[model samples]
Target: MKIEVRDVVKSYKHKTVLKNITFTMEGPKIIGFLGHNGAGKTTFLNLLAGLIATTDGTILVNGDNVFNTPSTLRDICFIAESGNFQEEMTIAQALKANSFFYPKWDEQLAQRLLQVFALNPKEKVRSLSKGMVSALGIITGFASNAAITIFDEPYIGLDVAARSMFYDLLIDQQIDNPRLYILSTHLIDEASELFEEIFILQEGQLLLQKTTDEWHKHIVAVKGNATDVAAAIVDLEIIDQHMFMQEMTAIVHTGGHPIEGYNVTLESVSLQDMLVYLSKQKARSGK
Candidate 1:
């Protein structure tokens, strides 16, 4: 599957959520769609799922307009946080009902995952806790076998162990049946390794698209004397800086090259931290 967003804009009244955002992604890979709160991650995903209309521009999933396009819609399964399954329906009933929407539904996988996730098929959806609901959503997403599967912070009430299980499932599913899996998440440090490619948004604008490695490659932290930190990053892009007595710490973009020495210590920044700094950067001084 191929998804293309060309100059997309989404607005509500006078406020714009996504501003002329544009990007493309292909299938058979795990994609990380990342941003901070109010970065329009959810809004963008809603547009991709055809749940809402774009105020301007277009979004195409496999060369077909996703909005009102049943063909495209059937191939894309979006599982968001909370309220996924009907409150009145039993686990089995809900699966039986939703499976009909996907032509490539994997019944055996669905049944087996019920056991893997420790969910009883006969259990009522309303009785299950938040974590259980998230597990059901995860199961449905995988078993749908859709060309594009989206998980928008679906692990809301899940614990560390459960989230790790979901991460393992992502790798397992990719190996067995290669397809597109777009994951929008805030647990960047934990799931950073799962991303083959990533798109980041900041303050209603698209930030950058890069491989996970590329996202972390040039970002470094230099700490030492203020003069040494300044000298070390004089030629590099300084993302942010902090002063502490005589010494200082600065996050720098090293232009993809290793910095040898300048009386400072160079340390690798976490993927989540790097992204935070990246988002703080503006395209044109915040206009």
Candidate 2:
């Protein structure tokens, strides 16, 4: 499967949610869609899933416009945190309805997941707990076997144990049936290892897109005396800096080279820290 977003823009009542976002993702891989609150992550996903129309530009799935296209829509499955189902509909009925839209829907896998999540198939949608709802969404996403499957904060009310189980099941499903999976979540540290690549959005813009390994290689943190830290990072792209007393910590793009002879200690930056520092840098620079 191939997805292409070109100069895409989304707006509501004159307020832009996403601006000139462009990227291309092809084949089967797990991608992390990350951002702070109101950074347009969910809005971008909605555009891809054709839940909402783009205000400008275009989005194509396998060279076809995704908006209101039945053929392409059938190959795409989007499971959000809060699923919308008929209040009186039973879990079994909802799953059956979903199967009609997706050609590769697996009833057996859905049944097994319902059992694993301890959800009663006969229970009405409104009667299930918050976690149970999330579980139901997970079952739908995994069983759909769509060419493009997207999960937008799909573990909202799940406990630690249940979330762990979901992750495990997701890995197993990916291994057995490879497909394009785009996951958007606030639980970065927990789900970071699952992503082969990451796309970061900030303030309605596509801030960065890089493979997990490339991200690790490019971002570095250095700590030392203020002068030494600045000297060591000279000519490099510095994302953020902070000083406590005489010591200073700097986040920089190292270009994959060790900085030596400046009495500075270089360390790999965590994904969370990198996001924080980059956001701060953007803010400080009025970007």
Candidate 3:
């Protein structure tokens, strides 16, 4: 499956949330959507899943437009941070309902996930704990087997052990099913490994979109004597920097050589760290 968003724009009450955003993704892989709060990631994901319509753009899933078309959206599943299960229904009943909606639903996987999450199928949606509710959402999203599956912080209220369980299950199921997974989460480091590609939204703008491998390769962190390191990076734009009494640590968009006298330590940068630096840079530039 492939997702295509072209010239996408969304606004509420004259305020734009997504501005002229354009990107394309070929499926059967996992993607991590990273951004700060109110970065329009939810809105963007909603648009792709057809929960909301774009103000001016086209969202195509597997070559078919998702808006105003039920057939096209049937292959896509979008689960929010809060799973919108029927309050009066039991977990088993809700699972059955979801099975009817998605053509490729896997009952075995759902049942297995229920045991994995320690959720009782007979429990009513309203009676389940917050962690249970998140567990149910994760199970459904993964077992639905939709070509384009999107999860918005699917493990919101789980404990550390539970969250790790969810991550392990997601990885295993992905290897077997291999559908498109779009995950939005604040737990960036925990989920970064599952991401083959990355999309970053900042204040309603699509700031960056690249593969995880490529993003890591393009970024570098250096640490050495403050003055010498500063001189070495004088010509380059510093995304982020930390300074102490004598030495300083800085991250930059690597371009030229290192300073001769300074002892520089060039190290790999994580996607989360890169985004932090990028966001800080954007903030400083605005001021």
Candidate 4:
């Protein structure tokens, strides 16, 4: 399922949430949507899922407009931060409801995941714990087996072990069945490896889009004499710089210039650090 957003805009109560956003997503790969709070990530996801209408421009799934079009949405599954459950229904009823909507719904997988998460089908959603609710959302997302599956901060109230299990299950499912997966989360470091591509939003605008491998390519942390490191990075865009007792470290963008001697050491930048630096830069630029 290919998703294409062309010059889209969204607003609520005259407050603009997305501004002239445009991007295209190819199928059978995972994408990480990175942004700070109120960066329009939710708005964008909702637009793609057809949960809300775009104020301007257009969104298409496989060339089909999403809003009011069931065909386009049939293969798309969106699990938001809050999965609005039928308060009067039990977990079993909710599962049954989902099974009818998703053509590829897997009852066995859902039941297994529920068991793993220690959730009872007979329990009412209104009475479940926050973590349990999140677990149910995760299970729904994975078991739906939609062609395009999206999880918008689905692990919000989950613990470390539960979140780890969610990640593991997501990756395992993707390997077994390659599909389009878009994940919107603040836990970038925890889920970065699952992403084949990365998209960043800043203050209602699309900031960056690149393949995860290409995005991380040549990004290194070099430490050595402060002066030498500074000289070496004279023309490179430095993402971050820090100093220790006798050595200084600079996090440079891809293709950083090499410095002679001074014990330069290259390292991979964590996704969390990448997100923090990107957000800081956006804030500094007044975006």
Candidate 5:
């Protein structure tokens, strides 16, 4: 699967959600779509699914305009935080409806997932709890098997055990039939292991796009006496930093070079921490 977003701009009245954003997603890979609230992650995903149009530029899926091409829309499946299925439909009915929308829909997988999620196919959507509703969305998304599957904060009401089950199912699906999966959530630590590449959107612009491995390699975290820390980061690109009376901690982009002689203690930065600092850096720079 190939999705090209060229100079894409999305606006609402006087405010813009995305500005001159351009990126290409070539799959089968699990990708993390991350940003703080209102950073335009949802708008970008909507563009991919052709649920909304851009103010300017284009989003192309396999060389076809995503907004106007019916075939391209069929290749993408999107499950939102809540209310994806008709409230009046039974679980079985919703699955049957989805089978018509997604040409690649797998009834066998859908049935299997019902067992996996402990959902009764006969249960009515309106009578189900919020967690059950989310389970339904998960079932449909996985069963759709669309070329590009997107989940936008899709586990809102799911319990820890249920969310873990979803993650395992997702990993299993990738192992058996790898495809493009774009997920956006605040549960970074829980989902970090599944991401191959990540796109960070900050204030409606593309902040960074790099593999999970590359992020760790290039963004270094260190702590030491203030003087030593300053020396260590003098020539490096500082992402974020904090200072106490006699000590300091800082994150920097090392350009993948080893900080051989610095008297600082090297630390591991979590994915969520990395994103937080990266966005802060972007905001400070007014970019």
Candidate 6:
């Protein structure tokens, strides 16, 4: 599957939430849509899922406009933090309904996942806990087998153990049945390994998009004596810094410069820390 977003913009009233975002992705791979709160991650995802219309530009999945097009939408599945099921419907009934809509829906997979998550098929949607709701969404996303499956913070209210189980199941399912998966979340460290590419949104703009390996190559953390650390990164752009007594640590964008020979130790930056630094820098710069 291929998704193309070209100069897309979304606004509510007069305030724009997504600004001129443009990108194209192809093939079956896991993509991370990451950003701080209110960075328009959900808004963008909704646009792609056709839940909301774009204010400007276009979004195409497999060369067809997905908005209000049932033919194209049938191949797409979007599961939110909360499952969207009829309040009075039983889990079994909801799964049956989903099978009617999705051409590739797998009832066997749904049953297996329901058992794996310990959710009773006869339970009403309103009676499930928040974690169970998330589990239901997960099950729906996996079993739909849509060519394009998107998960927007689908692990909300899940405990650590349950979340781990979700990650394992996602990996296993992807291995067995490859499809395009877009996961939007703030748990960068835990889910970072699953993403082939990461897209970052900041203040309604697509701030950055890079492959995981490429992203790591552009930013690094350095720690050493305050003076040496400062000198080592003097020529580079510093995204963040910390000073404790005589020791200093700084996150710097290498920008193709060889960073060495300043008596400072350099290490790869964590995805979480890199994002924090980038967000802070953007805020400080008033961008």
Kindly report which residue stretches of model 5 are placed more than 4 angstroms away from their true locations once superposed: 276-287
Compute the lDDT of residue 50 as modeled in candidate 2: 88
lDDT score for candidate 1 against the true structure:
0.87
The best candidate by TM-score is: 2
Q: Stretches of candidate 3 above 4 Å error?
A: 225-238, 254-263, 278-287
Query: Could you say which candidate leads in lDDT?
Result: 5
> By summed lDDT, which 10 consecutive residues of candidate 2 come out lowest?
278-287
Q: What is the lDDT of candidate 3?
A: 0.84
TM for every model, in the order presented, reads: 0.89, 0.93, 0.89, 0.86, 0.92, 0.91
The sequence of per-residue lDDT tens digits that candidate 2 reaches over residues 1-287 is 99999999998996999989999988699999898777898888888888999999999998999996879999999997675567689999999999998999999999999999999999999998888889999999999999899999999889999999988988999899999999999888888889999888988998778888988777888899988898999988877889988889988877767688889888888778767776676677675
Q: Give candidate 6 regions above 4 Å deviation.
A: 224-237, 255-257, 260-263, 278-287
lDDT at residue 48 of model 1 (Cα atoms)? 92
Per-residue CA lDDT of model 1 for 46-109, tens digit only, reads: 8898889999999998788999688899998899866678999999999998799999999999
TM-score of 4: 0.86
lDDT of each residue in 1-287, candidate 3, tens digit only = 88888999999996888889889988788899988877899999888888889999899887788897898788888899774699899999999999999999999999989998989999999999888999999989988999888889888779999988878887888888888888999899988988899888877887667787667655677788886677767776576898877779888765444445555777788877877876786688672
**Per-candidate clashes, comma-separated:** 0, 0, 0, 0, 0, 0
Candidate 5 local lDDT, 137-230, one digit each (tens): 9999999999999999988889999999999999999998889999999899999999999898888998778898888887778899988889
How displaced is residue 246 in candidate 5, in Å? 2.3
Clashing pairs in 5: none
Q: Rate the local accuracy (lDDT) of all candidates.
A: 0.87, 0.88, 0.84, 0.85, 0.89, 0.88
Which runs in model 4 stand beyond 4 Å of their true positions?
Answer: 218-252, 255-266, 282-287
Worst 10 residues of 5 by lDDT: 278-287
